[model samples]
Target: MKLIFEKSVPGRCCALLPACDVPVRPLESRFARKDPPRLPELSEVDLSRHYTALAGRVHGVNDGFYPLGSCTMKYNPALHEELAALPGFAGVHPLQPQHTVQGCLEVLARAEALLCEVTGMEQMTFQPAAGAHGELTGLLLIKAYHRDRGDAARTKIIVPDSAHGTNPASASMAGFEVVNIPSAPDGCVDLEALRAAVGPDTAGLMLTNPNTLGLFDRNILQITRIVHEAGGLNYYDGANLNAVMGVARPGDMGFDVVHLNLHKTFSTPHGGGGPGSGAVGAGALLAPFLPAPRAAAAGGGYAFETPPKSIGTVKAFYGNFLVVVRALAYILTLGGDGLSEASENAVLNANYLKALLAPYAPPACAGVCMHEFVVTLERLKKETGVTALDVAKAMLDCGIHPPTMYFPLIVHEALMFEPTETESKETLDWAAAQITGILRRAAEDPQSLHAAPCTTPVGRPDEVAAARAPKLRYRFDTL
Candidate 1:
């Protein structure tokens, strides 16, 4: 496959436009560029084929069993897409008069009500664009709430070592000093470490319920209680909410703020840099500090309502409105009862897959998992020089996308798998077979595992070089 630019032919045409009928407008002299931009010059057929080929090269939930742990790569329904594409919602303008877009406002207002109910939150804002964005927004709310009450000393946010990398990053970006707490041997929060970490400067604790290792922290309530007792707000990461949705909730566990990944848990198109909705939720304590332009009901009609001491607009014109539409559709379609079943099924599928693969690839934790599981290849790596990466690349050769590799930091040579609820038992069995086959191959022919993924179009590149010196765009000189 050649680069699109490489296929460009001089003066090649696509007939994308008609001759201008109106008066030709010239760019202002200051805004004009010295040279015309060079782009891929291809016929319409060539362009279509290029993208089609590109799409085939990628692996998505539609393509295979995508068990990327902590990232719920489930199969989102097509109905949600149709709902998002509805003209009434998709065509609405942010600058339109509030009274004119009642349907759009109602969509958000209804979504807020239902989502708040689901999470046990008093209020929510569909203002943050992504999960990490929501984390920053939620933290800012905590910061604003404390400062509003004259507790400015609440400056440090406690995060468990098992938290998503974005947790500490979001806290730091929100201008809060982050305090790291270690996880206990059982993969839950180390209670004593958390207790020792909290003090007068404590602002909050940020964590997910079922952590990255896919074990639901048995001490979740106790963990949140310890923070609250120490005068710190609890911020739920909500990344693992897929494991507990409807079955459990962060608000019930005493979290003050939470950021739900609508793209992940709520059956929306995810990955490849998304138009995602983080959709921050808050308890009564932090509701007033939610981001502004929140949808509300005024009399019989819906309208935008800013909270009293809001953190202000997190994103211009309510974050990723169409994404919210898709998410809201998912919530409504499943409803409460269906959501509980989905969560339970998610747990069941993960545990089933873990059981199938446990003999070949041992899980990092014992007993049943919540909605995902981790397998460590430390012993395998030592015995056969076949690291987790080797097994992952080997799976790619088997026409399967590998689970998340070397993550959560604690487990050596880690591979985390989330067999989302959408996967059929047959699919799980097949995936397990493929993985176990790869593990067998890993030991039988370690050299082949070292040079795994022989079937992929591109295999075994200088990863470090690619990362450190990425060639992000085409170079005119190369052309």
Candidate 2:
């Protein structure tokens, strides 16, 4: 396929506009650029075709199965999208008067209430824009709460080795020193290691229940108790909340602060970088320190309030508002019972896929998993010199988006798969068969796997080069 710029033809345009009706204002010399900007010139038909081709190249949940683990690449219902796109919700600006945007405010308030019920948190702020941002916001709340109590020496955040990388990054961003705790052989947090890590300097623990390895920690309550006993707050990274949505609540697990990935767990369109709603929820202790201008109940209506001891505004206006609308739509559409069923189906799909693929790529942990699970290609790699990357690339040839590769850091040649609730048994079976076939091919002819993904428009990107020196946009010289 040629770049759109390569297909550009001189003096070609879609439509000729009428003469300007308004008087034109000349720009000051200081405000004007020395050279006219260069852009691709193409006829309407050519431009449309070019973009249509590019769109086809972009694979999304709508395109096919996406089992990217820990990301919850599930199929969000289009109904939520339709509801979010309604003019009253989508057209309103944040700067609109409070009374005028009452409907928007009410929607936000209702969404917060539903999320609170699901997570068992007292108060929530839809400020932080993504899960990591939520993590940072939650940590800041912990920091403020501890400092307010004069426990200023508490500056360390304990994170398990099996946690999302964002866990430590968010902690560090919040100016807290991160203490790394190892995972036990069973892939849950090592309780003894956690115990050893906490002390006077410990501020909190940022944990992802049903962590990156996708195993729910049986010791979650005891884990939170240890932190609370040490005067450290517990922060729950609700990335894996899909596995336990209505099944359990983070607050019940004793977490002081929780951050939910509304985009992932809730039915919001995320990925390709966001427009995600992190939406931090807090237990009573951390509520006072939540980000400012939170939606609150006022008489029979909803109003925004900055908590007396707020950490100030974390975002301009509220969060990604439309994302909130979509999430809220999902909650209302599913209701309580449907939400629980979604969780159950998500867990069931994951376990079923894990069982099917066990022979080709054994899981990183024993026993059943929750919504997602990790499988390592250690044996396949040793026997066939086909690393996890090769298997992933081969999946592309099979018209399947690959599982997350080399993640959770702990698993060797990891391929984390999360066949979320939206996937059917037929889809799971096809994915399993594809993996099994790929592994067989890997063993029989490793070289072909190494050169896999011949089916895609571009094969075998120079990943290291692309990362270090990316050609992000088109340049005339590149042609």
Could you say which candidate leads in TM-score? 1
Candidate 1 has an lDDT of 0.90
lDDT for every model?
0.90, 0.91
Looking at model 1, the pairs that clash are: none
**In candidate 1, what are the lDDT values of residues 293-316, reduced to their tens digit?**
889999899988889988888789
Residue-level lDDT for 324 in candidate 1: 84
Off by over 4 Å in 1: none
**In terms of lDDT, which candidate is strongest?**
2
Q: After superposition, how far is residue 166 of candidate 2 from its true place, in Å?
A: 0.8
Reference-based TM-score of each model: 0.97, 0.96
